[model samples]
Target: MRAGIIGLALAGAAVPVTVAAPQATTVPVPPAKAPFTFQEVMVPMRDGAKLQTVILRPTGKTGPLPILLQRTPYGVPQSAPSQVPDSYKALMKDGYIFVYQSMRGRFKSDGSFTFSTAVHPDDPKAVDEATDAYDTIDWLVKNVADNNGKVGMWGVSYPGFAAAVALADPHPALKAVSPQAAWVDYWMNDDLHRYGAMRLSYATDWLYMLQHDKAQDSTFEYDQYDTYDWFLRQTPVAKIDQDYFKGSIPMFTAMLDHSNDDAFWKKQDWLGALKKTTVPTLNVAGFWDQEDPWGSWQIYYKQEQNDPDHLNQIVAGPWNHGGWHGRGDTMGRIPIGTDSGIQFQQQIEAPFFAYWLHGKGKRPDFEARMFESGSFVWKSYKHWPPRGAVEKSLYLHVDGTVSFDRPDAGEACRSYISDPDNPVPFRPRPISPTYPIPDWRLWEFGDQRFVGGRPDVLSYKSAPLEHDLTVTGELAATLMASTSGTDSDFVVKLIDVYPDNYEQLREKPELGDYGRSLNGYQLPVAMEVRRGRFLESAEVPHALTPNKVIAWNVPLRSHDHVFKKGHRIMVQVQSSWFPVIDRNPQKFVPNIYRARPEDFVTARQRVCAGSKITLPVMAE
Candidate 1:
């Protein structure tokens, strides 16, 4: 059950689940020296599905111990220390019973596992994750050997998503909850489509892994080294299943069947279901969390709506998906200026669980703890966006310069031809899968210089900043644009353009070779894409009138970063983010999944000069 089986095989590829196993070091707590024991038990649900559960307890307890639960689909952690690695010494040192369980239809558990839905409060007999959690807690508080009634939940990625939804309606004993880089909505945020653009590489590979075999752990095998080329050769989208999947992953079919964000996905919005709950929760995120960066923000915002007790708190760091658990001080080539992961784990995460479960510390101020990206500093806020934040719009000029001033009355639209045949690569030439386990995790940090100069991409940058310009909170682009094709895709990237002498002036050491020069590194802070057909309504599709200018609003996920003096704020526009996102085809099609090769055509797109991006800039 070692979570090291992270990328338990999906169809054929090894898309490892994001939970990282801790090392084998132990903290210096005397109570942790108590004898340890493990037990495998089946906890039954209201609907009679017995979940496979593992309970690790310190038999030599000095007193009553709290129950710490981790629920996952990537099999349970090993009964040995693999289940309780050295990283856990911090929490284990505090003295508590650790519980790991396999969700239904996973491993030896009794029921079917469907990744599509969360929970339906409307149904009296619904047996979703929330109910499963409720039932499990109820059973443990009564049947488990421990005496303390308090329980805490934590997980990363899918297990993280499990931890999140479980708290939608938590039991009384459920005290503190932490959902780290957990997935929320499939359509609007997280692993699949981003704002309706299909993440071809991720979804195709993940679905294949899930639907192919019921084994506990396995990895997908690809005949070629580069997936970008592999998926290209298997274009037309429909052939993915026809060629290898053979309709094996019904989830894949279900994804394409829903052309829009209809009820199928609406019911899966985990954040939308938090209106009534008031559990003291800690939502952890990574500014570079390519997988679920948008999820934690959306979850935190929705939780803030009714958090009168101020129990909901968020921690957005410079880490990647579960990066706080991976490396503490750095992400990609960017140093956090501190051992942030260690800081969060020991200072933030451990103490958080301790305060709620053991009643050892004072309640937090409920402020958002954020790692300022550009400046490489950690700043705590009484509230996110830090109060007096200003909304500034950087207008797109005909001259390709992004400025704070409006366009000067001229035909200032920037036009680019979108060719599906030669779509812009999301990464370098040989793009690998999203998970090479460790290395693939850092791809989101790849330098923007890869696609910066592409003909299909339109880039707009402002003059060098004379002072530190820090942006916090939400990011969005308002565009007046048109396309020659009836349907298209629009991608907007917000970047931080370092000074040409960036490397020379800086003294920090570089981390990895992402294949780019640091002299003038173009680092992307945030980005997103909107499928043209869904511009009107995510649940509906409409064709555009060729050459007619219309409004396209693209939401670039929120962030906290400072653009230092001499740096430039840039924006890049394109119609496709290949392989990562399927080709738009640039033509109208009710279901892009079934579109023929003929439906794929070249289209001329235009972004008028009046268009501008709104940045959430905080007043220093």
Candidate 2:
């Protein structure tokens, strides 16, 4: 995957020179007969550190040209190759110059680099990124030929974060930007944490593998693949800390230090600083992006409300994190059944850049675009969720039922015993070579067939629908129940169940079958789990009295899906989703890292009938 090559090239310190020369990989570059000349240059930062940059200049004898820039920690190709045949070619062929720069402390650049999460200690909200980008543009406008002074910027993921930073105090030449899948809030939902619970496996593995350069003699190294395998094979839950996490990356320490959404997080948030941008933007995200989908949508909403002239647009697809990069494949156990990557990069992403960078096409018609998952079709709206969509609640009924219709009788509650010692393992399915772990960690979609029948899993389902119904927008589950322990965790899953004709298989080709032949598919669409102690507030830790029910709200992100006439809507409530989410000690503990086996206990968990899952329904 060339995963370590970029890091090694960037580190440039005296170490094992085992890495091979950079590969001649193609990255959608423009053609020779094309209107632009592609060249590599090093752009200097304000601190006199040089950043590697790739510049595409318009062909002709003239003055300076307008610039389209992207600053990424990901490497910039030493030379730009021709664009891929199957992808969109408009942006490359257009006259505007394209620029990609390696961010400070990365590839061929001088400076100490830390992931954006650690930026607060070194620089202000957008100081480093903005400075680097501004300097790059400043150099391009003067040095490049056939020039115009205008500039635009765009990127996805980390680069997307860079794009957001570029706009903090933008360059005079910067005109527009599209920061898709960009992160605004780090602690709340980016890779490190989810709903105040630390994601131990992904966080540790990512930091060790990607962030820490071995040249630094960092005291962390794991057989990335085997370490997780061994942990999963262990007998009980308590051994994981000592076995895999001890002396590793300080991930647990970072997690414990920021237990709440406090000043520490606010200082790093990019959303507030983004209002300073005075140019157009197109924010993109996927409905199921497990990493930072909320941040993407939130960025769009905040921009539109705060800066009316910013030309903000949003496009959300039925995808998981980074799903737009590749063709449709199974995410864990569920199949979304489409080439979301091609659809996004070719149709929405390409056009956005073409329009903003070259003024070459019509502005996209819809203010917001989203693809409904089960129905497998794209829909556009005047605004996010549209004006008339109403928030409706589907109460969790007793006797294993969930319905939008209110319960006509007395309050009823379903109960299960939660044992942290034998906490439910996440991604219980087999491992895949492409992923870091073997379990369904990448598959955020709910698939309950594995845990449906377990005594600890409480399942509530609705009857087969008589008509097609489309649900669009955010979903939340409000549980008005209690636990029988000092502390516990609650996991909620919303699923769509297809009829028995729906077949389940493991291989890749089986994805095509599940998409076509399924008469009904009971696939989990959205779910969330929160620690009971953090329910009241992540800042304050409150212990629960045994068997006392407390009201809790678990908000799942937005999703667009059409449940066919014969399909049923199901909601699964449980106390734990282990490995993926760390086990809640079931007792109030100072930190999960310090939790002992004796702290684990079996507690009675309940979901009362009055509790419900709320969905935003767009009236026909």
Candidate 3:
């Protein structure tokens, strides 16, 4: 129920003219040639450092038009140059200046770039981006003649992080910002390290790739190829040191040194700095965005609670990290069935600018919009999911059942053996040529389904559903069991099983029913995993008492889905989720970073009637 912006194309120009603009101020438009003109410009930072920027302007002479800006460490040319043919053409044709800038020391920007360097109390580089962003905005508004003296900022992933930093010291011209899939706290959310265990493959590979000295001309090609190869190899990250990871090691070391939520992580927390944001903000996240979805939600909620007048809108969709990929119509594995991407620009993004920058339309109505997965429906709410929803627990039963009612019958438990040496590989099959870094692209549906039938995995399913059920909210598992060995790991998975009779109909006419349809549907739906170790707290490692029962709570990421009548809800429990999560050696060791093969041993894992996986179920 959103209103779309309709613009009239200038007689011979590419820019679309605003109907409500003053007649005297309107510029003569030319025939549509291309959406925007691209240029490379050097933006000066507050500290005198120069950052490279890619500018995209509507293809005609127009009065100071509103600006849309994005700052990123990932090179801008990688995707910004060809935006016309890409899905963002609507935004370009509608008359807005697009600016993409490189962060300090990254790509062609002048200055040393270090990941999370700004989080360090002593790091000057972190402060540089903020001041530099403010300076750049000031300069853009004054120098760019076409600029309307108002700027709106937007970016995904690392670029989103930069956008958040820019708002910390916003320029006078900057008025609206949208940060999607942004990484707020590197330690708690990012791939490098989750809890205390090392995310070996992803961290190592990422550091190895980003380690090259960009300053050395001779190292360019070598670094690119080496980094590319490392991503394909999927090696353990903990072993990488200064020898292999040059400048990048410092960031990793810093993350390791500050395991707790000390001043280090707090400095990087954009949520803590919510008071600094004065502009209208739109935050976007995805249910499957394994990297920073939680961070995005946290930022939006914090901002909404802190600032009542500021128009803050949040959109949560069913997508992985960076899944938007500049596309306006398509999302992840599904096509929008219409020009949904263009609709988003004309209806959502464009109007947002009109209201905030141009002072034109009514303020956005809803505070948050979320796309429910499995159900595939979009829901709008004044605030986040209702706070009235109580915390209800669904207990795990002995005979492979999950129920809301606690067991009054005798207590029962199920046991499985966990061997770290023969750990469950992350994907279902062997990924011999795995990426050294944990890239979602490397592990697709095939990879995740690979571990489905392993002996170490214990699966429990509900009888074919008698009625449709929808689950929405954060999920946690409380286990009351003991380990036969000193320490062990426990893993949980939530899966949606498609009915056996369900058939995928092909939409592609050429391939007929056999040909894959671009608009095809997936039968199995979705699945998620959480890894837990008995001896270690998510923040710290504690020695496990042999044969002693202890309480452990494992939290799975948030999700929304519908189990249609006859569809099954399956819960799988295991000790290890290989490759994605590193193997716990079973023996209590001080540092898993340097564990020997001999340290791994087989241990008994139990899931009894007393132990249960609790799910937050929403009444249909």
Distance from true position, residue 524, model 2, in Å? 1.8
lDDT for each residue of candidate 3 in 487-545, tens digit (9 for 90 to 100):
67776666666565555564544645533332222222233343334235444556788
**lDDT tens digits, residue span 1-620, model 2:** 49799888878877666987787988896646644467877777666788778876645525444577778776775654444334324354554566778777766767756665323223553346666777787887787766677787877788887886666667777777888788877666766677777666566555554445523323344443443364444333334445755544444445555566667666667666666337777787867676667777777877777665547778877776656665554544456677666777767776776676657688765687886777776788887767767888888888788778897677668898888666665654442322333333355664567787789988888998888777887788888888888888888888888877556555666546654544444577787778777777776777888778678888887778887777899888888876666667788876655566676678889877678888888776
- In candidate 3, which residue ranges exceed 4 Å CA deviation? 1-34, 78-85, 117-128, 213-237, 242-249, 253-267, 325-346, 388-391, 432-439, 442-449, 504-540
Each prediction's RMSD over C-alphas, in Å, is: 9.6, 10.2, 9.6
Ranking by lDDT: 1, 2, 3
Candidate closer to the true structure by TM-score (higher is better), 1 or 3: 1
Q: Which 10 consecutive residues of model 3 have the lowest summed lDDT?
A: 215-224
Ranking according to TM-score, highest score first: 1, 2, 3
RMSD of 2: 10.2
Write the residue-wise lDDT of candidate 1 on 520-586 in tens digits: 7788888888889888878888898999998899887768889899999888889999888989888
TM-score, per-candidate, Cα-based:
0.90, 0.82, 0.81
Off by over 4 Å in 1: 1-36, 58-61, 82-86, 505-517
lDDT (CA) per prediction: 0.81, 0.69, 0.62
